[model samples]
Every structure is written in C-alpha cells, then in structure tokens.
Target: MTTTREAPEPVTDVELVVLLDEGGSPIGTAPKADVHTDATPFHLAFSCHLLDDEGRMLVTRRALGKRAWPGVWTNACCGHPAPGEHMETAVQRRVRQELGVDITALELALPDFEYRAVDASGIVEHERCPVYIARVDGELRPDPDETVEWQWVEPERLLAGVRATPWAFSPWLVLQAEQLPLLAGAA
Candidate 1:
C-alpha cells in the first residue's frame, strides 16, 4: 500500500495595523480596512523608493479605486506593517503585492519620517512612516488595484517636478523630497 500526503492550505490572516499613541508608542492594533477616516489615529507605516540598475527612481500612480490619494503619483510603494511584523518584511511584502517585483539592497533611509495629511475627499492619513530605498532588477508587473501606472525617472527630474507642482503629487512624497539629500541637489 502506498500513501500520499497533500499540502496544507495556506493561512490567510486578517490584516491589522499597529496603532500608535501621541508619543509614537504602540497602543494597539486595528483592522486596516476600517482605520482610515477623517480622524484617523496615528499608525505605523513605511514608504519605499525603488531604483533601477541605471539609477532611475521608480514612481507609481495610485490606482483610481484607492480610498485616499487615488490617481496621484507617489513613491514606489507605501504600506502599513502587520502587527508583530518586522519593518523590512512588511516593505518587501507590499512591494511584491503591489508592484510584482523583487528588491535588493533594502536600506532604511529615514528612520523617523512621519506625516499627517488630509486627502481631497477629507480622508486623513496620519502615519509614523519610515522611508526606505531599494534596487530592482526586473520588469515591473504592477497590480491595477494598487498601481495604475509606473515610470522610471531621474531623481533630479522628479525632484524638480515635485517642487514645481507640489499639487500634482502625494503630500508625503512632496514632503519627503524636501528632506532627502538624494533630491537636495535639484533644489
């Protein structure tokens, strides 16, 4: 008699975000889908800037169906980390899920980046978001639900564009460019 074993089903965990107090301490966890509102509480999040081998930065336009900042151009990716998940792990997960690409040389560029912005629709985004920079080496396969379009652009050109028309980009990206030395030369 021969016996065969079948692979077990994968577990699908409900996505929860780590909420933060005014002092930037973890207060609790909240369901991701229900957290954003006009009075969204401060939460932990991360942003990534992806670069190609030729040194062009990868930027993406948010999907029109996104709840906040839809159809707006922004960084390579941004996402909230799962409760108890490591920062780098969350970044990698979101990059793959949203852009369908792999990254290397992942480094934390801004360890204390935080922002609070209100979307045109009045949805508030208050996040203690750290910034990361990474390199990609493959063709992008962006998900339509997370990204509507993408482009590889020179850092200087992106900085100039953001500075020239701040209203054309996401608030966080505009604010980040002001502080990042990588774009400082363009100023």
Candidate 2:
C-alpha cells in the first residue's frame, strides 16, 4: 500500500494589511482577506514590474478564482506590505511568493502611483500603491492559485494593447502601462 501527502497550503488568514489615511499615514491594520470589499478601506500597497535583461516586462493573468478581478492580466506582482515594513522588503518577499523569483534589488519608480478601482464583482481596491520596478531573470514558477498564464511583453506593445482593449486587463495594469512612457531608465 502507498499513501500520498499534499504540500501544506500557504496561510491566507490573519495576514495584516496596513490601513492608511488620505495622506498615506498608517492609521491601523486589518486582515488582508477581509480588507477588500465594496467599501474597501484605503491601504498601503505596492506593485512590482519586473524587467528582464532583454527589456521585456513580466505580466501575469490572474487566476479565474480571484474574487476581485478574475482572469485579468496585471503586473508581475502586487501586495500590501505589513504595517511598518519597508516597500523594498515587501516587494522582494512578494515576488518570491507569487512568481518564485528572487529580486536582489528594486527601486521606487513612481512613489505617488495611487489608484482606486472597483471590479465587476463590486469589490473595491482603494490603495496607495507605490509602483516599483526591478530588473530580474529566473525560471518563472507562478503559483497556480494566483496566476493562470504568464508572459514577457514589450513595454510599448503592452501600452498599445491596454489602449486597444482596456477591459481585458486589471485597472491597475492599464494605469501602469499608461505610465510606461514616464518610466525612463526603469529597466
């Protein structure tokens, strides 16, 4: 007789997100899973765009099971840093968690990149998201629960696609692509 065991699942509960005031002050903390609602509280978050040596940007299609924005393509990764955590540290951790890549160094390309978006399911995301850009390369091993597909894309081409089919991507991804022209020397 033989037996099989499954890998321990990552904990989703009790993950803390730093609540923020209008000016981006950390006012309080809330569980990550409960933070996004029709009336989402403003929170501090970060989005990371990874560029390879060839200058291709990494993008991922959100898994269909995502409650907020299912099957929509977005940046390499994004997440809220725990209260009092550095954005750089959070980005490094998240990139490893979501994309299975180690990010040695990263930079805040757009510190004032904030967005308020409501998905079709009525879940709201009101985040003070500082966009970070990193140049990294590795064999991508995306978490099946988080991503359904992945790709490397040219920045200019990505911008054109976002303009042509805006609805096909997450709101934040579209916004990021729009700001690509301003991200000189990011790669």
Each candidate's TM vs. the true structure? 0.92, 0.88
What digit string (tens of lDDT, one per residue) describes model 2 on residues 58-142?
Answer: 8899988988898999888999898778888989988888888887558788788889999998999999999988877578888
Stretches of candidate 2 exceeding 4 Å from the true structure: 1-13, 181-187
> Relative to the true structure, how large is the alpha-carbon lDDT of every model?
0.93, 0.85
Best by lDDT: 1
Best model per TM-score: 1
Which clashing pairs does model 1 show? none
lDDT of 1 by residue, 24-91 (tens): 99999998999999999999999999999988888899999999999999999999999889999999
Q: What is the C-alpha RMSD of each candidate to the true structure, in Å?
A: 5.0, 8.4
